[model samples]
Target: MSFIGIKKNITQKDTAEKYIGDVSTYISNNYSNNIKVHDIAKYVNITGAYLFRLFKEYLHTSPQQFLINFRMEKACELLKDCNFTTGQLARSIGYRDVLLFSKIFKKSFGISPSDYRKQL
Candidate 1:
């Protein structure tokens, strides 16, 4: 490839990386709120479909999956500290339904939230 083509490729890659970072940061900062792929795409100034493709290309995961994993990881940290009830944790992590939160948590960590807390 020509130097100009190489430069364009590098710039595009950088932009893609920035978009991924922006999306990840937004999710981390707003995980307590109801976030959608559309919302994230808007925040990053891209269409939802494009954002999905970018995530798949760069992170090998869907946006929704990334959000789920992020929330679950946060839940694990909060559980370790023992600062909140399951319901509170659920709500704080953007899950209005405690049961749903528990289900996802168990699926991710191989233990219920209460059981995980107990182990901690």
Candidate 2:
């Protein structure tokens, strides 16, 4: 009785789950770039639909929402520096348009970036 086949099956399952971490690392490293779900899926060699389902199953959110959360968190960290202008902060987190960044930031934290910085 050999257990090698069972171990191989477990290894394959682990490899499948590895894609989630891979996608997260890719997002973290390149969150500054204008990356889309498709880009992330391509990195994991999966379809965008599969990536979405994977995220939903594992992380309880879609990739797009996860990206938004990541960007907003980065914005919070950058907001700690009072010297950074809104436009600069926006660009740092892959948002080219300051207004859109402000909108999303406000939506996420219920405060404008400037006001958030002021609180800090």
Number of the predicted model whose TM-score against the real structure is largest:
1
Once superposed on the true structure, which residue ranges of model 2 sit more than 4 Å away at CA?
Answer: 1-13
Candidate 1 on 19-86: residue-level lDDT in tens? Answer: 99999889989999978788999999999999999989989999999999999988999898767999
Estimate TM-scores for all models. 0.94, 0.86
Give the Å error, residue 14, model 1.
Answer: 0.8
Model 1: pairs clashing at backbone N, Cα or C within 3 Å: none
Residues 54-76 of candidate 2: C-alpha lDDT, one tens digit per residue: 78877889999999999999999
